[model samples]
Target: MDSSDREVRDVNNILFGGFTELFCLFLFLVSAFFPNSLLAGDLVEQWTGKHTRIAWVQDQGNGLDTYGRSPDLMLYGYDSQDGRGARPLLTQKSNFFKPLITP
Candidate 1:
């Protein structure tokens, strides 16, 4: 194409790219500024008598031998009369706790 046509194409490309970037930035800003609608309703409804489970693995230090650590899963439930209580449901000791890597 001619010089003018190339310049026009370049300008169009730059404009389109800038528009896309601005649109994405606007969407990000909107989401950041607005509280999450899904979680904004009620605090009591979110945690009242609800059960939460967490799965994790631990590590142990031993010499000349190794052991397989079991998967630890814990369930947490909140009760109004139970007061604030925290407990470690499961624990294991293994080297896998640090430098997590997949086999």
Candidate 2:
């Protein structure tokens, strides 16, 4: 084929690839924004194992250093039956504050 024909084919290929990528990205974003409508009882039960309550705690700063603040902590617990007692399953500490070291 001639040089001009090859150039046109290349341009068309690039445009088609870009459009496909953009369409996939748009679909993902739309799905993420929509509320979850499916029932997740089985999944929740399998993960949490029976009756469980997740607790999250936010440590309020003393108002001394407004820039550097600690993140909130998350805790998971499981309690079964009447007055069975609560058991802590997992605990995690997150860092939502500004990092001390520069990237």
Model 1 C-alpha lDDT per residue in residues 1-103, reported as the tens digit of each score: 5797678668867867676456335433433443343232222225433432222232223332222233232322222222222223334333343232222
lDDT of 2 by residue, 1-103 (tens): 6797688668867867676456335433433443231223233334446643332233344534332345543332222222322223345555444322211
Candidate 2 regions with alpha-carbon error over 4 angstroms: 1-15, 35-103
Candidate 2 backbone overlaps, count = 0
Residue 17 of candidate 1: its Cα lDDT? 62
User: Could you tell me which 10 consecutive residues in candidate 2 have the lowest summed lDDT?
Assistant: 78-87
**lDDT against the true structure, each candidate:** 0.35, 0.39
Best prediction by lDDT: 2
Looking at model 1, report the run of 10 residues with the lowest lDDT sum: 73-82
Error of 1 at 90 (Å): 30
Each candidate structure's TM-score, on Cα atoms with residue i matched to residue i, is 0.22, 0.22
